[model samples]
Target: MNFAFSLPLALAAALLDVTVGYPQAVYRAIGHPVTWMGAFVAALESRLNRPTLAFEVGRASGVFALALYLGAVGVVAGLVSSLAPSGVVGFAALALLASSLPAQQSLDRHVLAVARGLEQGGLAAGRSAVAKIVGRNPETLDEAGVARAALESLAENFSDGVVAPLFWIALGGVTGGALYKAVNTADSMIGHKTERFLAFGWAAARLDDLVNLPASRLAALWLIAAAAVTPDASAREAWLTVARDAGRHRSPNAGWPEAAIAGALGLKLAGPRVYGDRLVDDAFMGAGRREADAADIIRALKLYRASCVIQALALAGAALIAQA
Candidate 1:
């Protein structure tokens, strides 16, 4: 089936994404664990094997975990659907449950919190907030460093959190979307460059990259389009920056939106960053404009809002087309 329910389902998913993720900080404070046990198991599996063996085990473990999660979600959706007042209500509930489980809004909020902390001259708070979002050490960062990290995360996650799941949902409805989320969760938890995960997380990471490729590009395009709508945003700059710098990053996908945002704001981004004890020398994107600051953070938020508008419009249009 082409999943004719995709459009409304996607809308339901988006709403659920917002609702579930927004309340997480409160829920976390109350010690309600949002932990993905499946991801933890996959991570452990990677740690127990030799390089090649680890890779095999990790891949198998990740796939199995993801399959199990998706299956569970499906079963739950089926049960809920059977009990719902209408087929439409059942499908909507399924979509909401599937899409709401991903951490997009929560991730965005965490990044934004870091930026806000830096803006308020709360360097310590900024570092603490940033620590929650990224794998890198935050204690050594200055204001600009923290802002850069948050903005970069905003760009990268625009693809991961929003676009990737949306793409799968468009293709597969609730079940397909849930499967993508499980794979992505697996990648996030175990896909790392560390010795323990290098072998095991390789498949999950690579597959995530593959799935995110098109979505990332689309995110970049949407960002550029969104920038075009703003009074001072520059589409030409965004496009040129993306063209020149999008390929320079370690990830095939992250560079797209980062470059677009860099170009749109007429500022530079993606230089050296410290991850744990390691220093990563990354290529700079965009032409030299101004140093990153709180204003840039506000601009990033604007881009984020614009992206949401675009997503909503696209989903609406898709629904109309489907109905036709």
Candidate 2:
């Protein structure tokens, strides 16, 4: 599929996801696309990423594993896309499936849960809620830390979970979105600097970075626009942060949205933090305050919601132009 058709398809998918997110009952019954991809990633890593392999061999195995995973995802998505009937009915059906690719509603729910946890249950509750979404050790966090982590996750996932899939679907249909999700899942599961994954996950990590490039930048712009319209947010600060500090983060892509939102919301993010037992010394994304709280989380959520609206409008506008 090309942009002419794919743009509306993506717009429809985004609308569906935002209005009617994947039902919990459905998720419990069939799991998610990401989970399905995770199972495949685990199996491949278990089989191909043997501990006995040399570094070069393991790296090669990683490349092959990534190829296999993406190939399988593409084929499955293509087959599923084909099952839809021709015309508008088929487009609706495909959009329904593609809706699962983006997590706008779910991300909002999860982050909002953190804000509620902080407001209602204090630091411990905040930690519990944030732990569900963040990889960092929850116990290490105070209320401020928990809030910051949640906001950081919100910004980063806005790029990965929402923008990335829509971007791919607008380019290559649901198959492309599924492929991007698979690569992202592979990176999450096995892409690490640990001894076991350093070599075996290199390809997945690198490719994830590469594929996310456009979406990451776009997500930042979406946030910048959101800030411009948001009452309390500073669009100028968002732009300035993205220009100055987005490149400072260790991650090649995550810094874009994080910096924009952090500056827009007047908060610091992605500074030195602990994940599990490791204390990763990363550069800060914005020169804003570090002591954020539940109110700040709410502000960030406002921006996130605004950004989603912006994304939908962009999709609609692009589709209209394409049709014309």
Candidate 3:
């Protein structure tokens, strides 16, 4: 991809996502690209992740499956970029396509529903709403647990769904962004240590971590800066928590943004949690109150929005610099 063209294209896509997001109408009409990737991954997993298969065979099949998925997504995005005129019209077209990949508005909307549910209907309502966003077993979650799940999901998705795509688009244009989404989709679908996916998801999980490293760190920085301006959010606490607790989470990359949000909002996150029948004994991320409420979810959303603004300004500045 041309660096000059992609720089502004990334900025434009970010702005467009913040402004309009992916419309539900469009999603209903053609379905989102991420969902399409998820369908493909699910099909591959069902076909390749046979319980009778040897572990090494499953692992090799997984690697090949992911490579195929990435190659297909990259080729399609490359075609989109190549077919367009390398002019204002082309940039706009690419930016519009790129906008569908990011999840700023979609994330905020889902998180907000959880907060609203908690406020209006208490734990049961919150659990129902939060279930839509988190993978954990929400059946046993209390009000605080539901709220914490929402906040954590907001932070983690902020990294994977927003910053990661922006990072890739700046470096590799629409193809890069789509490829990241494909990998992320695979990881979410199959990258589990469970009996079913332990071998089949190894490649997806590792590659997702590698690609998200830079974006996750940048997400931490954005959270720290956003904390400086957001009410009830501590920039110092964000930095300290990230330094102290980011390495504590199970994921190599998810911890950065989760810890940053935890410290910024003065709420602890990511302690022992239940996913299906298994329990994950994850370390706490912040040394603050453990009982998160709807108010805390709102505060996290504030920090998330602020972080997005920081990302946008930085990308826009870079685009301007490239033009100069």
Overall lDDT per candidate, in order of appearance: 0.74, 0.94, 0.91
- Give all TM-scores, in the order shown: 0.85, 0.98, 0.97
lDDT of each residue in 207-255, candidate 1, tens digit only: 7888888889988988989898876788889999999999998888889
- Residue 116 displacement (Å), model 1: 2.1
| CA displacement after TM-score superposition, residue 233 of candidate 2 (Å) | 0.5
Q: Choose the strongest candidate by lDDT.
A: 2
Clashing pairs counted in every model? 0, 0, 0
The full ranking of all candidates by lDDT, starting with the best, is 2, 3, 1
- Comparison by lDDT, 1 against 2, better one: 2
Clashes of 3: 0
Q: What is the lDDT of residue 273 in candidate 1?
A: 81
Return the lDDT, model 3, position 156: 90
By summed lDDT, the worst window of 10 consecutive residues in model 2 runs over 44-53
Model 3 alpha-carbon miss at residue 299, Å: 0.8
Task: State candidate 2's TM-score.
Answer: 0.98
